[model samples]
Structures are given as structure tokens and as C-alpha cells.
Target: MNVIIWNCRGASKPSFKKRVRELVQNHNPAILVVMETRVGGDRAREITNLLPFDEAIHTDATSYAGGLWVLWNADRVDITLLSSTEHEIHAKVKVRFTNVSWLLSAVYASPRNAERQILWKNLMNVAELHNLPWVIAGDFNEPLLSEDKFGGRSVSVNRSLLFKECLDKCKMLDFGFAGPRFTWTNRREVQALI
Candidate 1:
């Protein structure tokens, strides 16, 4: 099944919506996982209607920036919101094509190492309980390898190590960081020859 995960930063912008629409038209993934929606209340509903998918699970409550949202083609998949935490969201569903159960998690890890460790532990517990083939995707905010970053130290080596440990514990595989190598860019131009 085709799945698209993006950190839209926020879907409130006109340009962002237009770009997302373009992506939908081109990719038409069976499931769409978005992070940092930065949307709330009626605005979230407005954004959901634009997509082909009829069902969505958005952040019920949050303590930080943009919450998570998962939209899927209702007819093709059955989704149930298992649970959600302050920093992570979890959903359990069965993909019709494979007749296999899967769990999809959208996570926005805290930048702080201590908080991130806690998040990692919580995720492991969730994964263990579900006991299904799963895919967790979002702005993990940490890259496993040095290749994931451009220049300078990537920061959070210990945190990145923890992320890797969680993935390994859950027996999950990285989808190979498809699309753009760098999802964010600074306004100031700094040329680097790699």
C-alpha cells in the first residue's frame, strides 16, 4: 500500500494547502500521515475535507506545537484510534488488500534528551501491546546516520541512538528517508559541496 508522511509545519497557509493538494493529485497514497499539522478545531475539519480520505484522527489534546493527523481512505481501510500521549499518537488498523493488521504511529519526539527517552519508552510499550506489523513515521527529529544531515554535528547523538534502539526493539525498518534529503531549510544561504 502507498503511504505518504510529511511534516507540513502547519496546514493553515494557503501555499501549504495548495502544495498538499498537488501532492495528493500526484501520489494518491492509500494512507496519509501528517505531522505538525498545527491545526485545531474547525480549521482541522476544513483541512480534512480537502483530501480524498473521509476519516481522520487528529490530536485530541496537546501540550506542544502542531499536533498529529492521520487520514485514510475509509472504504479501503478500517482504522481505530488505540491511544495517544502527550508526544505521540497511535492507531491500529487492518489493510484490506493484505488482510493484515498494522499499527501506524505518528510521533513528534521532544528535542530534549530526557523527555525523548521517556517518549521512546512509551512507544515501546505501545508497540508491544499492539503486536502487529507496524510502521511509525514522522519528523523523528533525529537521523540514524551521519548521511541524514548536511553539515556540522547533527546534535543529539545519544538521542538518535535511543531512537535506533527503539526501532530495533520493535523490529521496525526505516523506509530509507525517501523524497528530499533535507526536509527543512534555513533562509540564509550557505553553500556546501558534498
Candidate 2:
């Protein structure tokens, strides 16, 4: 099934809403996974209503960072919110078209290497327990390889290795980076600084 994952930075911009609409019309994904939504409860509800999706789940906005939301086209998918933590959300659902069951986890990793390692470990544990076809998608905040970056920066050998190991151990594929080579930019307008 088609799925879209984006870290919108925040949902405050009119551009963000316009882009979401465009994505829905153009991609028509069964599921839309959004990160850094920067909205909670009422605002989240308002935003979800504007989208074509029938249901949405988001964490408490009071949390340190704005939370995640999974918007699903109810006609094409049956979504059961399995669990949610401060940094991730887990769901168990079947893709309507293929009838493929998936243990889907959408995550936004901490920028710090140490915290990310811990998060990855925890995520891997959950995946191992389920033993179902799984997809983990979000702003990992760490490039998998030197090639993933625009210019040569010292790729964190240990962190990169751990990320790869976690995915391999969990049997989840990276799916290859799509759209822009870099998903984030700095205020300076310098490209590929992430």
C-alpha cells in the first residue's frame, strides 16, 4: 500500500496545509505519517478534519516536542492504535488492498547519538516481539551513510553502524531515501547541512 512520511517541521504554515492537500490528491496514500506536527488535541483535530482521512491519532502537545499523527483513509484501511510513547507510535493494521498485516512504528529519533541508540534498542525489542511485516518510517535525524549527505562530513561510524544493525536485526528495510536528497535545511539557507 502507498504510504507517505514527512516531518513537516511544524503544521503552522499555510504552506504545510497546502502541501498536505497536494500530497493527498497526488499520492493518495492509504496512510499518512506526519512528524513534528506541533499541535495537540483541538488543533490536531482541526487539521485532521481538513484532510481526506477519517481518523487521526496524536500525542499530547504539552510534551517536549510536538507529536505525531497517523491519518488513515478509513475506507482503505482499518487502523488500531496499538501503543504510543513520547517518541514513537505503534499500530497493528491490515492493508485493505493486499490484506497484509503490518506492525507499523513511526518514530522521530532524538538528534543526540546516545539517545538515538537507546531509542533504536527499544524499538527493535518491540518489533521482535510482534514478528509481523513491519515498516518504521520517520525523521531518523541521522544519515545512514556518507553518501546520504550532500558534502563529505564525518559520518558517525558507530551511530551509523548501530542504525544499520538495528534495521537488519529487525528485518526492516530502509526503503531508500525519496524526494529531496535532504529532508531538512538550516535557517542559513545552506543546503544539506543536516
Clash counts for all predictions? 0, 0
Error of 2 at 193 (Å): 4.3
Cα TM-score of candidate 1: 0.85
lDDT of 2 by residue, 90-193 (tens): 89878776757887788877666787888788887886688787788887777778887665367888888999988888787766765776655564545545
Over 4 Å off, model 1: 60-64, 152-154, 191-194
Local accuracy by lDDT, each model: 0.76, 0.79
Candidate 2 regions exceeding 4 Å error are 61-66, 151-153, 189-194
Q: How far is candidate 1 from the true structure (C-alpha RMSD, Å)?
A: 2.8
Model 1 worst lDDT run, 10 consecutive residues:
185-194
Candidate 1 residue-wise lDDT, 39-100, digit = tens: 86677878888867879888732443657788888777888888876557788888776768
